[model samples]
Target: MSFNLSTLLMTIITSIIVIVIAIAGTRRLTTGVPKGMQNVLEWLVDFVYGIIGSTIGLKKGANFIFLALTLIMFIFVGNMLGLPMNFITVHDEPFSIFGIDIVTQQMINESEIIENGHKVVDVAWWKSPTADANVTLAMSVSIIILSQIFSIKYLGFKGYVKHYFEPHFLFFPLHIIEDFSKTLTLGFRLYGNIFAGEVLIGVILLMGMAGIVPLAIWQGFSIFVGFIQAYVFTILSMVYISQKISH
Candidate 1:
């Protein structure tokens, strides 16, 4: 998939927002009672921990809680970025900066529209990073690689290789294919859901341009979908990791 500059900018902005929230949330962390951001942070931590404990077993899951939290938070924030933003399209007429002409161009979800016999460029901002296959596949590949590393750490090189031949030598290819399938499915599942959600929201906004009701409803639902996808991705990652490391 192509990497759009707009997507990169949104990703960076999402990361910064998450970092700021984390820092602010923990700055006044108190042992006695949590309040404000700390309370929200604690709730999220507990929720993630519970998911880990249920899926991968509490003892083994503890080792990967930080990774799980990071994945969920990043994905969730990225998924939510597009919900409240509006897309803007600038006319192809060149704007000058320091006497240099810069033509306006569309980035992600670009569409062409003719106005008064002239074609104008449309640009979408703050598109979800998870909506991009490249970002999702990268995350999936990272998780798969980490799973293999954990498998080797616990199972040794010989044992790791031997996992492919379990049950019979004929099953080796199937086991190898399973690894590739896991990566593909994990990546596409997340990308498809988030991308579809964004497209739907865009359609709703366009259709209901004169009214705020449709946009308001879809935004709320999209936020819920974003959180659910984050949890699903994280839990599935934990499951894959547990499977690899299990004897």
Candidate 2:
């Protein structure tokens, strides 16, 4: 009944569908030239590969196809997950996962609820996974860890530490801090933009059917946002790896 609970339910169902599609497509790709869904999936994979290879160099990009594909598919599905709801419901209720405490939706007024006891929370129908800070932070941390792994493999311990200091002694701390800040910003920036877009969509829907006028507009804008976010995520990951491996 709570907003979080509803969001979780929708997200879970959406994720299952995405996973199933991915698995089916993956299995199909191993046998022969891709066809149907497999064809589409392969095209997506190739597109991601092209972008990554061009930006990071073929050797580095080929190694990163796994991360690139995961990000692109996850984000694409997350963005499209909430597209199919005729009526959206919102309510103030408690949420528990496997009997563990999580969060509850707090309602300020009774006027928000309909006769069915469902409160029409603004934009109650769709939620974006990338809109969550935890998801983005988790992804950013993964990229940082992978970069460090590459650094350790390519550069010996001495090189790793020395590279951070760069051309001067005075700027060492600043360089280290900048590296740390990049990880932080990568997470927060993606979360903020995607979440803002999600919220904006909700607001537009609340403005009435005329709001539907802008639905097409926002959908077009969202496609751009989705592609940009995916590219940014991949670019930052590649940049980190390149920085680590560079002399």
Question: What lDDT would candidate 1 get against the real structure?
Answer: 0.83
List candidate 1 stretches off by more than 4 Å: 91-120, 209-211
Give stretches of model 2 more than 4 Å off.
1-18, 30-34, 83-89, 92-99, 102-126
Best by TM-score: 1
Best by lDDT: 1
lDDT of 2 by residue, 115-192 (tens): 467544433445666776767887788888888887877788889888877788888999878878988998998888
For residues 20-110, what per-residue lDDT tens digits would candidate 1 score against the true structure? 9899899987998899999999999999999888888888778898899899999999998878775564755434446543333434124
Least accurate 10 contiguous residues by lDDT in model 2: 102-111
